[model samples]
Structures are given as C-alpha cells and as structure tokens.
Target: MALTSARGWQFRQPSVLPGFGLALGVTLLWLTLIVLIPLSGLAWRSSALGWQTFWSLATDPRTLHALWISFGCAFLAALVNVVFGVMLAWVLVRYRFPGRRVIDAMVDLPFALPTAVAGIALTTLYAPNGWIGAVLAPLGIKIAFTPAGIVVALIFVGLPFVVRTVQPIMEEIDREVEEAAATLGANRFQTVSRILLPDLLPAVLTGFALALARGVGEYGSVIFIAGNLPYVSEIAPLLIVIRLEEFNYPAATAIAALMLMVSFAMLLVINLIQAWSRRRYGYGA
Candidate 1:
C-alpha cells in the first residue's frame, strides 16, 4: 500500500521536463542559427590575420579617432535623450489637453520612419540653404556635414527609446503616493523630487542605456549627415564599410569585434543596475 500510494502521489505532480526541454532546444537552435553563426564568421575572418596585424589595424590612429568620435557622439546624444525624453514622457502621462493624442502618436514617428529617410530629412532641414538651416547659418551655427550633424542624426534616431521606455512607467506610477506627499505639506517640486524621482530612476537609466546602444550601432541615419570624412566626422560603422570597400576584411572584422565587446560590457552593467533597482522597488510597487 505504501508503494502504491507513493506512486500515485508522484503521478499527480506536474511534469515540466518535456516542455522545458523543448523550449530550451528551440531557443538554443534559434540563437545558434541567427546570432552565433554570423559572430563566429566575423571572429574567424578576423583571426585569419596574424594577431600583431589585427592589433595594428585596430590601433591605427585613424581607426582610434573614428571609435572615439562614435562613442562621444553616442554618449552626448543619449544624454540629451534622457533629459528631453523624461520631460516628454511626463507631459504625455500627467497632462490632458487638445491634440495630446496627436502628440503621443508623433512620439513614435522616429520608430516607424525609415532611418535613411530620417537622415535625409534631418540633412535637408539643417543644410545651409534649407529653410531652417538658412536661418541658423546667419548665426554661424553650421550643422550639416559636421560632427555636430552626426550627433544630431544619432539623437533623432535614439529619442524614441528613452521616451517609450519611460512613458509606461510614468503612467503606472501611483498618484496616491504623490497625493499623500502633498497632504503632508510637500510642495509640487518636493513631492516630485522625493516621491516620484526615486521610482523613475531605474526606467530612466534603462532608457538612457538603450538609447546609447542604439546610437553606437546607428549607421543609416548618421552616414548621410556625417560627411564621412575620415578621422573627422566619420563614424566607426562607416569606417568599417570603408575598410570593406578597400578589401581589408580582417581589419573590418577586428574593429567590429572590438565594438561588440565594448557594447556588451556596457549592456551588462546597465542590466545589473536595472536588476538591482527592481529588487529595491519590490516587484514594481
């Protein structure tokens, strides 16, 4: 009887082994096919060159300049997005007014617009003889075909990341908390600073990191406005393309691998912060 009862109890328990195994197999297969294969090819191609040759190519002055410019512009663009995106998200969530729906829809335009089209539009708007550019040119603020232009293109493309990431979090924030702070005689500024900012910090950082990553990898929009001047306005992605055009496959792959490593490290740090924030917040309370 004891043996029969034990068997019955075991049979009543749910069996996840088959389903878990199937899911894991499918995920691994997909990652191997879509991600691992291409990355492996890049690494293999890079390794074809001797290690010294690879190191020389990656550390060349021009290559280093391009990398520096790419990261600097991406950092600045992401910073700009963090400030304005938070304000935009706050307005969209906390206020109700005419044309609010239209404004909300427009915030997503960057996401849907073709990157090339966005680049072209920005170039046209900022070009010397263009309508907006014509006015600014008189003031000595040149934008098109400059490094500033590259930062502008990146900012245009990355804005949606910060806005979208923060918007939902702002919407879900409890109004009661703010009201409680207010009832305790906290002013609007104090209430927002003390009650709202802490809760929103994680989402803000996540958005900033995402925008930074996108800006770092951005090519289509930046290429049009950057002028592609080597060691000047050229970005790392464009440099990679130029290397490929020159048939320097090993050099291109080496640069790509380096960028991938740096980006991965940054993403890992951002994810750790996000996890820690979530734990502090106690399951999005």
Candidate 2:
C-alpha cells in the first residue's frame, strides 16, 4: 500500500488489485453477520438472566464438573497431539516409506467422517466387550464411558488439526539447516531442539490451539463414549445441549457464553505465543 497526497490529506493509493475495497467490505460484512451477530445474541440473551441467577447456574456443581472435564480432557488431548502430531509431521515430511500416501490420506478420515458415527464406532471399539477393551478389561483397564474415553474421543478428532497444521510448516523447513547443524557438531537431538523445533513452534502452537478449541466444543463424538454420567464424563457442550433440551435457554446461553469466552482467551494466548515465536526465531512471528 502507498500513500498519495490529495487535497492537503494523504490517502491510501489504490492498488492494481481490483475490488480491494469491495473484498474488504464483503469480508467484514460476512464476519459481522455470520460470527458477530450470533455471538452478540448469545451474550445478550445470557445477560437477560440476572447476575445472581447466571452465577448460580454457572457455578452449579454439575456444570462445574462438566466444564472441568471438557477443558481438562481437551488440554490433555491437545498436549498429546502437540507431541505426536509433530512426530507424525516429521515422519511424513522427512521419510519415504511404503503406503506413505495411504497413511497420509487416512489422517484426514476423521475430517470426512460424521462426528456421531465416529462416536458410535469408538464406543463400540472401547466397550468392555469390544476387542481392544476386552483385552484391556482383563488387565483391569477401562476406557469407555469414562473421562478417559472423552480424552480418547477428543484425541481422535483433534489429531488431524495438529498434523495438517504442522506438516506444511515442516515441509517448508530447509533440510540444509539440519545438515548445517550436523556439520557444526550438533547431534541429532541438539539439531532438532535447537533448529527445527524452534522454527516449528509457531505452527505447533497454532495446531494445539485449533485442536483444543475443537475438543472443547465436541459433543456427538463424546456423548456415546462419555457414558454421560452427570458429573463424571459429561462435557460442557453436552451440558449446554441438555440445558437447551430442557428449555432452559438462559442457562444454555450462559454456558455457551462461558465456553465462548474461554475459547477466545485460549486463542488469544495462542496468538501471543505465535507472535513470540516469530520474534524469537525470526520465522513465524
């Protein structure tokens, strides 16, 4: 963009790129209509409930438990994704093996599969009588219908976000840097930690936030496997649905508002981390 002097004031010079103003206008118009409008309605409706009532509903034991399970499991799953997703991205980018393309495509199956179907399939696989669960049951392990089951479900849905986000960044990294590190007498671990990981940090953080956000709002894929025991495996999103189903609009709005605020805060933190990484490493910041 350039500035041009016009009538004692400076204005942005128009670019050859046509429709810049129109494009920006359309973008903002859609953002306001599709995103801001609904969010505004949600907040307004929640605010209609008196503060005391809203507080009571938000602080209810079941609601508290559900929120905890939702956030805690999502955080755990996101952390796991950050670790394994990076490794998977690394493998896909750096290695060539048989069935590589097939495995790469399989990573996106969750994206195409309906969440409800995913939930049922996962539940079937994790039920005590199911093959994997049957083997674990003999060892006194149980997953289905528990908090662990929620985490598992979340991990399944969230993995693709991390893998996809990090893979492109990994591919963009120059192999010459790794070779330089090796020539500098840095071992493999040192090379990865000092060079590649630093450069990938921003993308990793982005992927983690996306995964966490998705996990927080997950419902269908969790309900079947969660066993939905009031305070045990219930998620905040499910609680909101339950409230809505009972015609408790105010309560539902309040819970939805809470999740919205929390998710926003998380995204803000992720953005901050990305900025810091870019500044520190001179790549993504």
Candidate 3:
C-alpha cells in the first residue's frame, strides 16, 4: 500500500522551517490584519447602503464619467508604457551610449520624486503659457488641467514599472539565440518578433498590470494637473474625496467599493494573461 493510500492528495515536502502550521497561521493573521480586514470593512459599509442606493450612487452620471476616465486613461497609459518601456529596456541593456548611466538613473526619478511634487512640476511645464505649453498654445494645443494631463502624469508614475520588469528579461536574452536566428537567415525584425518579443510578453503584462494599478489609484499627482473639474477632468478617487468632504459617507464608501471592484477585476485579467503566457511558453519563451 502507498504511504498516502488512495487519496488524491500527496505528501507534502518536509520543510526545514519549524512549526509550519504556526507559520501558516501567522501568515493568515498578518494578511487578515493588513488587507482582508480593511477590505471586508469597506464591503460591509458598502452593503449597509443597500443595493438600490449603492447602485444609484455608482451609476450617477458624474461617478460613471469619472470611473470611465480613470480606467480609460490608465489603460492607455499602460499600453504606451509597454511599447516605450520595452524599447527603453532594450536600448539600455543592448547598447552603451554616452550618458547611459545617467539615463538609467533618471528612469527611477518618478519612483524617488514625491507624486505631488512631480505633478506640480509637470503642471508648471505643461500649463498653457508655461514653457512647453507656450509653444503648444500658439498651435491651440493644451495639456494641463485636461484629461491628457492625467495620462501624462500616469505615464510618468508608471513607466518605471514596465522598464524595470522588462529590463531583467531583456538582459537575460542570450546573444547566441539572436546569432542563431541570423544564421538561419532571419532578419532583425523577424528575430525580435519571433524570439525576443514572445519571451518578453509575460514580464510586460506583469508590468502593465502593476502600472495600471498604480495609475488607477493615483491621486496626489493627478489633482494638480487634472483641474478636478466635475464630470470633465474629475477622476474617481478625487470624486471619493469630494464625497467625503461633503460628509456623504455612504456615497463615498459606495464609490470606493466600486473602484476597488473595478481595479481588482482589471488586475485579475492582466494576471490571468500573464499566467497563461507563462504556462504556455515557459519562462524564457
């Protein structure tokens, strides 16, 4: 007879760590305190609003518009980051140009810079009649206090995620593989498309998911550049603040709960895509 009998479950590998159950219990307790409990409270509060009231709050015109803008802008920003981030990582890893070190360091600027400060700086430069804006203003182009500005701020905040995620993967790509592709009569485009890009897809998706999450939740950097106009440039998080300021706790929590759900769904889809790619192609495919 097998040690595990006819059960589907198999014996787990012995762990070096003592007290596995204790460790698992502690992990559960930690996760509960840090994440699950707060989310549960938010859900409970939203439930207290009743389905009808919550639906009405979530479906209000301003709220709907804000939610649309937030998701739309975040998706666009993440898509842009995927392209540019891949190119940036490729360049940084493949070539040694002048100021390469400086350029590499500068990629982390958004990470180090406070979001509010970055927002103000971006607004100053992009505002109509401001430096870059002055040039664009004559051409009737505007950026600051517009939806475009939100995309720009999100791009700034989210670029590093993509770059960093994809960089290691790019660096790990073996030069010999490219050499072999060339020897097999493949051109640069074919080699990159068939070999490099497929391998990079998983990391790119993970980076996009992370950046999308950050862009969705971003508030501090966005407010200054967004103008926070109701139903025009307003974002969902800003709307939540507006509700809170007016002491509309029910509305605030309802909106918050909706945002949480939408964000979770978006991230979940991206994660599923990443997981599928990993399983289908293996890690370095």
Candidate 4:
C-alpha cells in the first residue's frame, strides 16, 4: 500500500524538467547565434595571422597610441560619471523638488538619442564658432575634433549607465538606518559617511564598471568628434575601421582581439571587486 501511495504521488507531481530543459537549450542557442559565434569567428580569423604578425600588428606604435588614448579618455569619462551620476541618483531618490520627475527622465536621454545624432549635436555645440565653444575659445580650450571631444562623447554615452544602476539601489536603501545613525549622535555628514555610503559603495562600483565598459567600446559618438587623426585623436575602434577599409582584415581582427582581451580583464577585476563589496554588505549573491 505504501508503494502504491508513493507511485500515485509521483504521478501527480508536475513534470517541469522537460520545459526547463527546453528553455535552457533555446537560451544557449540564441546566445551562440547572436554573440558567441561572431566572437569565435573573430578569434579564428585573427589566429590566421600567426603569432609574429599578430604581435607586430598589436604592438605597432600607432596602435599603442590609439590604445592609450582610448583607455585614458574612457577612464576620465567613467570617473566623471561616477561623481555626477551618484549625486544625480541621490537627488532623484532623496528629494521631491519641482521638476524632479522631468529631470529624472532626462537622465535617460542619452539612451534614447541616436548616437550619431548626439555626436553631431555635441560637435556643433562645441565647435570653434558654436555657442559653448565661442565662450571657451578665448581660454584656448578646443573641444571638437580633439581628444577632449572624445572624452566628452564617452561621458555623454556612459552617464546613463551609472545613473540607472545606482538609482534603484539608492531608492531601496532603508531610511530607518539613517534615522538611527542620526539618533545615535552622528551628525549629517557623519551619518552619510558612516551609514549611507557604505551601503551605496557596491552599487556605485557596479555603475562605474558599467560606465567604463560602455565608454571603452564607444564608437559612433566618438568618431565624429575624434577627428580620427592617427597617433593623435584616433581611437582603437577607428583604427580597426581604418585597417578594414585598407583591406587589412588580419590586422583589424588582431587589434580587435587585443581590445577584447584587455576589456575582459579590466571588467573581470571590477566584477570581482563588486562581488567582494556585495558579500561584505550582504546584498548580492
């Protein structure tokens, strides 16, 4: 009788295993088609260049200069976003000023605005005779068609990532903990420094990492503003494009592969830091 009861119970249980397996299979197949396959192809094409050729292409002086410029501009942009994005997130979450909702919506304008359009708009606004550029020309601050313009374009593209990532975390932060810190004789600055910041650090780092990653791969907005002058304002992506246009497929793939590896390594380190922060704060898995 016990055996029969067990059999009946087993029969009544829902068989979701097949459905779950089907979904997992579909997801893997989709990812392979969209991402993995193309990346694998790039690696394969680059491998045809042989080690010596690959090394020479990647280590070329012009290539090195472009890499340096790309990394430098992206780093500066991400750093700026880290500061302003956090402040914007804090304001949106903690305040209820007039036009707050409108301002919050504007934070995502970069995401909705086409990259080319944004690039053109920014270029026009910062051109020598343009409104903002007219004021700065007297001070000798050239923006459009310069390295500074690259940083500006990157900042424009990356700002939304930091703001969006930190905003939700800030909104979910417990107000009671802040109140408790205040009640314990901690001043406003002390309360924020000791209580709020610690909790926000993980989210802030995640946002920074995301912004940095986006800035590193940025192309559309940057090309228009960068002037594409080799060893000067040219970026890695533009170099890759130049190589392709010159029919140097192997060199292009090699440079792209190098960029991929470096970006992956940097992102891995950032993710590790984020994971450690989350574990320390008991916030993420």
Compose the digit string of candidate 3's lDDT tens values, residues 116-178: 999999999999968998899989888999899999999999999999999988898899999
lDDT string, candidate 4, 112-147, tens digits: 988999998898899898889899999999998899
Regions of model 2 farther than 4 Å from truth: 1-18
Best-performing candidate as measured by lDDT: 3
lDDT for each residue of candidate 2 in 26-115, tens digit (9 for 90 to 100): 999999999999999988988899899989989989988898999999999999999998898889988999999998999999888999
Order by lDDT, highest first: 3, 2, 4, 1
Q: Model 4, which residues run further than 4 Å from truth? A: 1-20
Q: Which of 3 and 4 is ahead in lDDT?
A: 3
**Highest-TM-score candidate:** 3
**C-alpha TM-score for every candidate:** 0.90, 0.93, 0.94, 0.91
Which ranges in model 3 have alpha carbons more than 4 Å from their true place? 1-6, 10-19
What's the C-alpha lDDT at position 52 in model 3? 97
What does the lDDT read for residue 52 in candidate 4? 93
Candidate 1 Cα outliers beyond 4 Å, as residue runs: 1-18
| Model 3 weakest 10-residue run by lDDT | 4-13
Worst-scoring 10-residue span by lDDT in model 2? 1-10
TM-score of 3: 0.94
